[model samples]
Target: MTAYAVAHLRPAARLDDEVFEYMERIQSTFAPYGGAFLVHGTTPEVLEGQWPGGLVVIGFPTLHDARDWYESKAYQEIAPLRTRHLAGDVILVDGVAPGYDASLTAARMREAQEA
Candidate 1:
């Protein structure tokens, strides 16, 4: 089953550029774990609740893969920079259920349409 990590970032003062730079480096480190950057910094207009200023979503092959990438020494080295930038709103959420079968879901939708 695939796993995902969704991060919400609210930058602290004087940390935007540094954090952005660090994130680039982080992406490089995640390559070996079959991680893909799904969304990076998509601004939200609907600011309901205590919304973070920025968002990042990453997809990994599995939950263990995601965890391994995070715990890896390479990521740990650069993680502090991300922490320093955000006012501590960074979160890693796992994707619910096993393997997202979007194609099957789409096919079902098409079948319904044909019906």
Candidate 2:
């Protein structure tokens, strides 16, 4: 299953040279782990709740790959380039399987609730 690395990053102050360097270096870190960006640094058109700062979404072949990419030495070495300057949350999440049904989950929840 595909997995994603999602980050909601807000700049601590203003983006500096270090962040730019991180951006320049980040692509190379993704190559070995089959990681690719689905979204990067785009101002979203918010229709509902508040959203501050940029969003980054990267897709991987699997959750394992996403984990590996994050733990890789090459990435770790440069992670501070971004982390030191940005405030945000990051997560790895598995994608749902093909032909999945929400009704199945609802049924399970209903059963648990009755118990």
Candidate 3:
């Protein structure tokens, strides 16, 4: 099944540049693992969490791919910046199913669109 990694970053004071650099590095590293950024720095309508910060969601071809990217040496090198910048929580979740039925999803989408 495809997997997703959701990162909630509460950037440290005055660490925007550092965070940006780290994200750049992360993006570069993701390519080899077949990962893509689904959402980066999106704000939640309801902020109920104790930690208020940036949110990043990454999609991977598989759970193993996501895990590999997270644990890779390349990512480890810049992980400190992420930790130092955000005093928040990071979570990785596996998607519900493998290989979505695009035709079905498209039909649903069209229905919703027509509605």
Which should have the higher lDDT, number 2 or number 3? 2
lDDT of 3 at 43: 70
Of 1 and 3, the candidate ahead on TM-score is: 3
- Tell me each candidate's TM-score: 0.70, 0.93, 0.74
- Which candidate should be chosen as best, given lDDT against the real structure? 2
Count of clashing residue pairs in every prediction: 0, 0, 2
Candidate order by TM-score, decreasing, is 2, 3, 1
For each candidate, what is the lDDT? 0.79, 0.92, 0.82
Error of 2 at 23 (Å): 0.4
Worst 10 residues of 1 by lDDT: 85-94
Highest TM-score against the true fold, candidate: 2
Q: Over the stretch 32-105, how does candidate 1's per-residue lDDT look in tens digits?
A: 99999998867867656766577778899888888889899998999887776575444455676766698998
Error of 1 at 7 (Å): 0.9
Candidate 1's TM-score:
0.70
Provide the global lDDT of candidate 3 against the true structure. Answer: 0.82
Residue 71 local lDDT, model 2: 95
Q: Which candidate, 1 or 2, has the higher TM-score? A: 2
